[model samples]
Target chain A: MKVNYFISDIFYVCLRDLKHYLKQRVRIMATLIQPIIWLVLIGNLMSGLTANPLTLKFLDAPSYLDFMAPGVMVMTTLFTGLFAGVRVVWDRRLEILQKMLSTPLSRTAIPLGKIAAAVVQGNIQVIIVLLTALMLGVTFKTGLAGIMVILIFISLFCSIMASISIALSVNIRNMETFFALMNFITMPLMLTSKAMFPVEAMPGWLKFIAEWNPISYAVIPLRTLVTKGWDWTVIWQSLIILCFFALCFLAGAVFFFKRARA
Target chain B: MKNIIEVKSLSKIFPGKITAVNKISFSVKQGEIFGFLGPNGAGKSTTIMMLTTLHLPSSGTAFVSGYEIKKSPRSVRMQFGYVSQDLAVDDRLTGYENLFLQAKYYHIPNQTARERIKILLNLVELEKRAKDLVETYSGGMRKRLDIACGLIHRPKILFLDEPTLGLDIHTRRQIWQYITDLREKQGITIFLTTHYMDEADSLCDRIAIIDHGVIKVLGTPQELKSRLGGDIITLDIALTHVAKIPRLIKLLKTLTNIKQIKTAKTKITIVTLHAESMMADILKIIQKNSIPLEMVMLKTPSLDDVFLNFTGRSLRDEAGNREQAHKARRMLRRIRS
Candidate 1:
């Protein structure tokens, strides 16, 4: 009985939240255009620069754009997903949340539905970036299977981030507090993810930090599949960790939000 | 009548400094409109906040439609609807789309939901502008749409906080009539809060006048009025009469049943069971004290009577200034921040 309610509620919320995706054509396009430009213009810009014969040790073997492409895609999703909570803030301000909460909808369904909607929205954006990368001669070495893997990688990554954002937005009462939370949390997670360089070139302490970062988990597995082909052993292990992070973040969010809203 | 709503000693204190809603108890019978009357700071919204499950009470509990608001909030919520004074509609969606969102939220069947949208839009008299985006709506139209949104789910109990606030007189009267019509026709129990004295007088079956987080009087408008009796007499005396009025009022209290006595600056308002009988004796005391009655008028008792009787202040006096209202909102918010 409970599970049925959960599924339907998620379906209902997602179906309706899609209206927002359509409504925010300008804002989404504006936010998404930055990453698209980076993938095409910057990726192409750095392509020739890094393809020189005497390559930097950190960028090793591959061109800079190629090495950086996976990072850019994941980073785009991370920021998009992380800041997705702002929409939830708008909903609270508009009393849409209060309206829904007063009804028979399941309380747990709300955050899950919002996160699911954000994940799908973020994936649409990821696909745009991927297609743009493809246009820029950034072919995936891992074929259709690699694209599938990358999609899963980015989806989980976005889901976890969106879940945190939803939790944060719902729990925090004021905009100022929310901004401060984003600064403390989102900045460090993005910077430490090894998005710019391979862990081999980094100092020992830095390498340890990179290995522990959840953002690193999001990129490395997908990057390996994209650039070098399959690494089955790590892929399965990383998928599990990603699932764990998504669950922990979402559960924490739903639980804390109930208390804060109460 | 079945107790469709029961609130027991509900208390909400903010951060150990502000007591938003003191331990107060009240209940609503099924199929009746209950009005929560208070000035801006009497914790009217806070009590509604607790009842709506938006703010948990520090102590106490409530049951709506046989489900505890805290323990089974979803079930409790399922039985009712809420329209907050803060006009929280989404401007992005068309009026129709917004209704669809609410229908989906309540798990209303799609077919029934469609019919409900049409019915409710018409019920609130917003049928012509249903396709327009809510952002494009006039203040009155948006408010009507909000009312329609609250009712779309066909909740047994509906809560409307300051439902007619900021509306023009015509629209306010229209809504006042519309709400009465809905309750009478649909048999939906309504819990409403308002600062407007007349709205309370005209609409509510029973009212609780609250101030400083405590309920001062709880009774039907007629019952509360009858308690005050015939008419209210206010004496705008010179400063010389300040000291004499209390003793004079005490003597009047002995001779006649003055429901309440409040001295504001240089004016003392006395509401009595017998306005004419008390006037003759009351004037003698003021005249003997060498204080002339600068102004005097006999008027009908209003919800303001209950407020002053309970809180020793008038709701129209702007007792809770805007600064204090925002400050109170922030005090509760600081915890999450």
Candidate 2:
């Protein structure tokens, strides 16, 4: 009985969020527009810069757009993951969070539902970007199996980011503070990780910081999967690191939310 | 009647040692409309929060529908519906959608959830606007839907915190009628908290008047009013007879039936079991004293009088002062920063 209620709680919460997301057509357009612009315009512009021999050697890919495709996918996931906190802030401000808490459902179920919806949404967005890349004549070196692995990787990576985002939303008092903190953190995270450029092309100091960034684990494996195809060592390492980040973030969220007054 | 809710010395002290709910205890019978009456900051909402398992108690516990709040919060939560001070419906969702989601959270079977939603929407008279987004609802309509959301799963007890706080007279009456009908039709135990004295007096089977984190008194409205011991008789004296107010109080006090006498500028008020019987004799004394009567009024003691008698201040005055103090504290923090 308890487990059944738990599943239903998660399902209903996720369903509500998804319904809300679909209802706001403007919001859907807004979330999708920025990433498409980055993938089409900026990816092409950056591809021109990587035409030199040193840049070509550093990138190690047949085409710059292909190299940047996975990076753009990872960036899309990161942006989507961070902004997933907006729903938490909205729910809290609007008393939906309180309403859910007053029910018999477990507290963890609420965040899990939100994280699941965000990961699913992020994956869908990533696929859309990938299709857009395909339309622009970008081909993946790997077959369907490798693309499947990358999709799983994006989902796991998004869950971690969504967990952290929701955790911050629970602790922060208002949307202005949440927006400011997310902006300050995401830009630095994206720059320090291998999202925009290859870590091998970076200076030694920058490479060190890039190596430490968790997003690099997600981006590196995705880039490898798209460019070099299936590699057990790469896949396993990325999965383990992503899982570790997800656990830490989820644990942090549950802890802070338990202590949160409302 | 069996007790549907039992609280034992439940308390909630916020951070910085501010006690929002001191060690206060009360219980409610099944199928009864129990009222927690107090001014703002009197801990009514805090008490409801504890009982509904929304906030953990600082020192004690409560049982709702036979489940201990601390030990089995989920079970306690399953046993009660809470209509909080703020509207809890999703503004983005239609009224039916809001209730449907809530029903799902409670794990009610889908078919039953649909039926329950239909029944609840009709009960609250929101069936006509069931398809409209709650953002488009009037204040009263939103409030009605909020209540319907609480009742979606048909819990054993319903907690309504200031259910009619910001409604017009007509809407308030409509909400009250709905509340009474719910109790009559469903036999669901109601636990209501309000600052409205008349609301408590008219609606509750019993009321607990709380103040400063403590319950000052608890009883049926009639019992509470009778505790004040009599009707209140007020005689407003003419300006020329203002000096005779103290003398009038002394004379009124000599009457054995007059239980209490208080004198203010140009007025003398008395509490007596027989205000009508004592009025002539009281007037005779005033006439003999050559003092002109501006106005003489006699009325049965109300819950307001009972509160004033017990708390030494009017409930409305306390509510007003609470707001003022809050503003003053906000200003002081601004100046200090």
Candidate 3:
């Protein structure tokens, strides 16, 4: 019975967030439009860079769109997951969080539910990105199984990003400050990782940073599944790393949420 | 009736060593409308937070419906409904949805939650707007919905931290009606904190006047007023004449009919046996001293007088400043959002 309540608490929290997300028509429009712009414009624009035989051989993909689609899907996830904490900040400002805290619901349920909502949203955007890529003539090498793997990668990556966002938001009360911090962190993470380019093409120092970047672990597996078939060696290494980071950040998020103050 | 809430020297000192709620002890009787009356920053909300299990006490503890707040917060939380000072209802959700979400927080089953939401929407008179998003709700309607959300679980006690702080007078009175009905109809004990004197005097069965993190006095409205025991002559002086308050009090001290004199801001309250008979002498002294009196009125002792007599300041004066600040902050938040 106790476990039942805990699970229901998480469900309701996630449900409320989804309800809010669905109500904002403009936000939904923006979410759909953003990934399409990146895929159609940036994907085509960067395709020229990989047009050379030498570059194509190094890229090991039929087209630039195939290599970049997975990166763009993870990028969308990155943006959504990082901003998930904005809701927590707003809830704190409005005292909705305090009201929830006063309830009998477990504190861990709050952040876990928010992470769940972000993962769901991340998957929705991933699907949209994938369909757009498919419409743009990008084919997956691993077929249906690869698509499922990509969804799992996005969910794990989103949970990691969202957990960090929420953990920071629990301490930082101001929305402006949270926005500044998210921007500072997101730009470095997105550009330094192999999201938009091949890490092999990056300079020595940048490649080192990209290899160490957690986001690359997520994007690498996704790119491999899309461009090169299911290579278990590469997939397993990145998957384990993603799972470890997800676990650590989720534990941190729950810890901060339990101590959240109005 | 037994005590529904028992706070024993509950104190909260923030990290900076700022004591928000000092060692204050009070017991609220079951099925009673108990008011925590104080100005802003007087530990009213802190006490409520501690009782609601949102903030851990630094040194002492409290119990709600026999569950200790610190040791068993979930059990304590299960017993009370909390309506915070800010509007905590989700604007994106319909009124029904808001109440349903609250019911889910308490683990109320869907079937029971729907039934409770229907009854609550009707009770709060939001039946017409039940399906509309709360963003469309007026200030009063949103507050009513907030109160209904608090009641969805049908907890034994309800904690309202300034439930009507920003609403207009009409809406404030309407909320008061709902609060009274909750106690009378459902026998739910209510613990509310407010800076409004009229709200406390009219609605609360018992009032605890707190100031600077301490409870100065606690009693029923009548008991507090009768403790002052006589008529009161209040003199409101202009801001320019604030310095003259000392002379006015000194002069009024000479009158045999006047028992005690208190000065808060620019208002001088004189406790006397017969205010009407003492009026002539008071006016003569004011006129001679050229104190520039703005207004004068003589009436029986009220909760305002009781507050002034204990805290040496008028509740209305502090509340007026706080109300302005509260409204400004709310306006800024609305514009920014």
Candidate 4:
């Protein structure tokens, strides 16, 4: 809540992590390769398969690639977030996290700032994936604002994940334990979300689970933005859920964080 | 005199029924050096977490630089620099970048940030390694960068939690020297915690000894040791003569000049209230007792002795078995998910 300190810590979070990431250019490039492969090889192979089945006459014409695009985008966000939380874990181990925590930076700034950096990184990845998708014949459906739409998707998912990451990072006091729990925590959550498959394709319970998953909201407006044209109803409803998750996650993270000191 | 840091009845408890810190009280005078001395898990780190506004305490309150830790943490953090034991410095970044990031955390203007980073680099003796990735540097070099990062903001007070830990003895000396020099030159109030008695003895003006969530003692190095009211005398009797120690201790305590006596199997140590005349008297008793000693020495009590005397355990012992550290990480992942 302290303006000067929070304002500065946000920049602190971005620049330090960015510089660290920059030095590992090879790793960054490697991480980007996974999503690029999905955009190219998978999009191409699955586009045909997804086309007819993904579209129903009542739902309007939706390309298989288009239907899969948002899912993939959110998947990128999800995967990117998976390790981002670990960055905090790494910070905890190396004592770097202690240095950051001790400074004049806000508790809110630490997580939000890192999340902001992830958003920027996520935006970059989304752009590359979008470009590759475009080359593979995926359309944006909406013109000129493709970049803007990509940024929005990045913010929605990054904010949600960043909040979750910080909350856990503070709580998790060690590294090996974090590794052991990853299967239980991150893997199941990612699989249950509607990232790679349609909600209808899922069984009843799973469909219900997907609907409840926050990532489902991330994909709703995102899929509409990429395919089947933009509809305010789906767009607005998706925005509401995403926003609710963002606020809820952040509030919850801060609250627990406050208790941790106590 | 203004107390730059004020803590009263501060306590923290983990949900798992572990008392990390009990109600403790202390304060730091502006520009003064205050040491928080404790073995690992004595809650030194936990206390620092609360002071720096990183972890919110479950009970009690603290004020730093005139701001309450609970009510105005952001403002409190702004006025201080907190260097931690966790080695927060990123290995990929050069020394300068680390400080630049710290400057950003303090919200320094860009023009000033550049100059401040340069100044801090020189202070930690990393001016030469300022551009190298920390990953390439030795442990000592990385530690220096971490110190430089903490000082970039020109904070009036600095909180250093075990700054010299994990360093070679020589490197520890260098850092100790650097901190003393900085304190004298800039008049920065330094708040530090350490398991190293020599670190507290050499660097701190006063210290608070904590163990098992309690502050057992608080005084200057000289004051704390002096409070025992004697010169510490150690007699290294042979292991075979271990039984002779108890009788010797009884005999030694009977000396008019000696105040307290204790025995540790093969070694008999005594504290003499009248230090000047007591050694000769003590030497006479060993001769009379026919205790052939391997070595005999007398000096002020080190921090280790103070700790062992108080806690009945060594700090190094608690540092063992880090498997639970990994378990803590798993719990972290679960909570996050």
Candidate 5:
């Protein structure tokens, strides 16, 4: 019976957020438009650099669009996941958090439910990016199975970002301070990783940072699935690393949430 | 009636070493409208927070519906509904959606929740606007919906923290009617906190006046008022006759059943057992002396006089800043949206 209440708590919280997300027509339009701009504009603009044989060999694909599709999908997930805590901050200001905390709902379920909703939202954006990439002539070498693997990676990657965002939100009360800190963290995480560029083409110091970056773990496996199918050796190593980071960050989020005062 | 809530020496000192609620003890009878009346920072909200299990007491404890707040918070939480000072309803969702979500949090079954929601929406008179988003609701409608949300679980007790703050007099009276109706129809005990003197006088069965983290007095409105022990008669003479005030005081002292006399400027206040019977004699004396009388006013002791008698300060003086702050916040919300 106790376990049943906990599960339902998570379900109801997630359902509320999902309903809130769907009701904003303007936000839905923005979500659809964002991935299309990144894929069509940025993907084609960088295609000239990969036209040469050396760059094509480095990219491990015939064209830049094909190689960058998976990276774009992961980047979209990264952006979506990092902003999940904005809703929490909004709820806090509006006193909705106080109402929920006063109920019998468990503290852990609050952040978990928000993270779950972010993952679902992230996956939706990933599919949009994938469809746009396909329309732009990018083909998946592993087809349907590879698409499933990409989605799993996206979910894991999004959870890590969402967890970190929620942890920061629970600790920081000011909305402007949270947004400033997010910008300070997000750009470096995205730029230093292989999400937009190849790590082999980077300088020695950046390669070290990219090698240690968690985004790279998600990007590497997703890129391998998209460009070089069935490479279990590379995929398994990164998958394990992604799972480990997700667990650590999620635990940190729950700790902060439990200790937060209304 | 038995006590539904018993608080024993409860205290809360925040991390900054600021004491918000001192060691205070009180009991609220079941089915009674108990009020905590105080100024803005008088620890009223802190006490409510502790009882609602939203904040852990730094020391001491409380029991709600036979469950200790600290030992079995989940059980305690299930026993009462809380409506905070802020309007906590979700604006993006419909009124029905807001109450449905609240019902789900309490684990009410779906069919029962629907029926309860229907009745609650009707009770608050929001049945006509149930399907519209709460953002479209007027201030009164939004507050009514907030009250309905609190009643969705049908808890044994309801805690309202400034339920009528920032509302017009009409809306405030409407909210009061709902509160009284709840107690009469459902027998639900109510614990409310407000700084409004009239609200405490007219609505609460018993009121505790708190200040500086301590409760100063607790009694019914009539009891507190009568404790001051007499009617007040104030006579304002013309400035030309100010010199005769001392003589007037001496003459008034000769009257029977007079308690105390005080003078400031041209006005003299006479506290007596019966102002009605003494009015004729006092007027005849004033006329016989030919002291240029300007005005005479008589008043029975009210809750304000009781508050002033105990706290040595007027309640309205302390409430001024808070009322302005509330206005500024409301203005900011309006500008933002």
Candidate 6:
């Protein structure tokens, strides 16, 4: 009975957040616009310069748009997941968190519901990015099947980032500090990963850092599936790493959420 | 009635040895509106936080609804609904949806949750606007909706921290009416905290006057007020030498009607049986002694006087000073963390 209550409470928290997402058209628009800009403008500019052998060697896709599609998909997930902290911060300021903590709801269930919502929303955003890439005349080497696999992989990756964000928000006092800290952290996460450029093209030191970055692990498999074709070894390896990453951060969030003072 | 909450030697000490609640002990009877009245930073909120299981006590034990606060927080949480000083309703959601979500948090079944939400909305006179988003609500309506959200789980005890802190007089009274109605109709015990003396005087069945982490007194409004002896005669003094106020107090104590006299820097309050009858004699004594007197007034004794009688300083001044002190402490903690 207690376990059932915990599950249902998590379900309710997810429902509440999803309802807020649907109600706010502005939030949807804001999250979508930034990634689409990077996908179109920068992707086209890089594709136009592909005649240079250096540029050609660095390009992962048949065209710059194809190469950047997976990067944009990963970027979209990271961007949305990092701001997952914003909602938690607002809830804290508004005392909504206090009310939730005062209830019989399980401690882990609250952050679980929030991270789940972000993952679900992350999947939807990636699909839209893929469609936009399709509109820009990009073709997938692994076709529709690859899109489904990449979507699942990106959702798992987003779950990890969202958990980290929630943990940060709970420990940080306010939004101003949260933004300053996330900016310092997320920019490194995005720039160090092989998201925008080929890892082999990076210098030895940068390449070493990219190899250790979790996003690079997920993005490499996504790019390979979108360009190289269906490879079980690559898919399963990335899936395991992504799942491990998600679990680690999920554990962190639960710890912080339990210790969170309302 | 039986006691529903028993706190023994409760205390909370912050990182730098700042004690918010200091070894305070008290018991709240079941089905009564018990008020924790105090100035800001008097540890009223810290006490509420400890009782609600939001903050753990440093060196004490407490039980809410027969469950130990530390041993069984989940059980303690199941019994009480807490309405914090700041409103907590999601503004994006409709009033009905907010209550519906609250019910789900407590694991109430859907059908029964719906019925309870409807009844609560109606009781709070919010059924008409239940479909509207809470952002559209007036301050009073938002507060009512917050209260309704707390009741969605039908908790045995309800904790409200300064429920009417910023509302106008009209809205404050409306909230008061709803509070009394809830206790009368549902038999839910209420525990509230406030600095407003009149609010405690009129609403609380019993009150604990806390200050600087200690309970100064505890009793019904009439009982506490009656402890003042009689009417209050306030005299504002501007002495020529400024050091003769104590001499004036010495002279006032000799008067037959003056039961008690408390002197501040420039004012003296005399608690007496007959302020009207002794006003002339009191003035004559001050004049005979050639002590400068600025003004004099007489009024009935009140909860504020009771607080003054116990704490020496006025509630308003203590609230102002404590707010600044708390802000400084918070800033320092933020920097350290």
Q: Which candidate ranks first by DockQ, i.e. highest?
A: 6
For A1-262, candidate 4 gives per-residue lDDT tens digits of 4576667777778766666666777878876687678766776676655556434432333556666777777777776664556677777667676676666567667666677777777777777777777777777888558458656867777778766766776666667766676656666776787766766667889888887887777877777777756677887777777878888987876766545531
Candidate 2 TM-score versus the reference: 0.88
| Residue B294 displacement (Å), model 6 | 21
Clash-forming residue pairs, model 1: A94-B88
Instruction: Give every collision pair in model 2.
Output: none
Summing lDDT over every window of 10 consecutive residues in candidate 5 chain B, give the lowest-scoring window.
B328-337
Model 6 agreement with the true structure over A1-262: per-residue lDDT tens digits? 8789878878888788889888889878976776678778898888887756766667746787778888889988997788788888888778798788889888899999998888888888898888888888888888888888898898888988899899989867678998998899888889999998788788999999999998898788888888789888988988988888888989998899888676
As a whole number from 0 to 100, the lDDT of residue A215 in candidate 1 is 86
At residue A85, give the lDDT of candidate 3. 97
Question: All candidates: CA RMSD in angstroms?
Answer: 6.0, 4.5, 7.3, 6.5, 4.3, 6.2
lDDT of 1 by residue, B1-337 (tens): 9989998988888775688888898889999999998766679888887888877778999988898877987777778888987777878789999898888877777899999999998888888888988889988888888888888878899899888877889999988987898799999999999878889899999988888898888889978977656478888976765677667667666755777887788888887776778888888876776777789888877667766777777777753544565565556456423
Q: Give lDDT: candidate 2, residue B141.
A: 94
DockQ of each: 0.53, 0.58, 0.47, 0.46, 0.51, 0.61
Give one digit per residue, the lDDT tens place, for model 3 in A4-47: 99999999999999899888899889988987898889888878
Q: Runs in model 6 with CA error above 4 Å?
A: A52-54, B232-298, B318-337
**Model 2 score (lDDT):** 0.84
Candidate 2 stretches with Cα past 4 Å from truth are B234-270, B274-296, B309-313, B317-337
Candidate 4, B5-49: lDDT as tens digits: 889999987766678889988888887889987765678878887
Candidate 1 residue spans exceeding 4 A from truth = A54-62, B232-298, B319-332, B335-337
Question: lDDT for every model?
Answer: 0.80, 0.84, 0.88, 0.74, 0.88, 0.86
Task: Give interface RMSD, per candidate.
Answer: 1.9, 3.1, 3.1, 3.4, 3.7, 1.3
Native contacts retained, all candidates in order: 0.79, 0.77, 0.92, 0.91, 0.77, 0.92
Model 4 residue A71 lDDT? Answer: 76
Candidate 3, clashing residue pairs? none
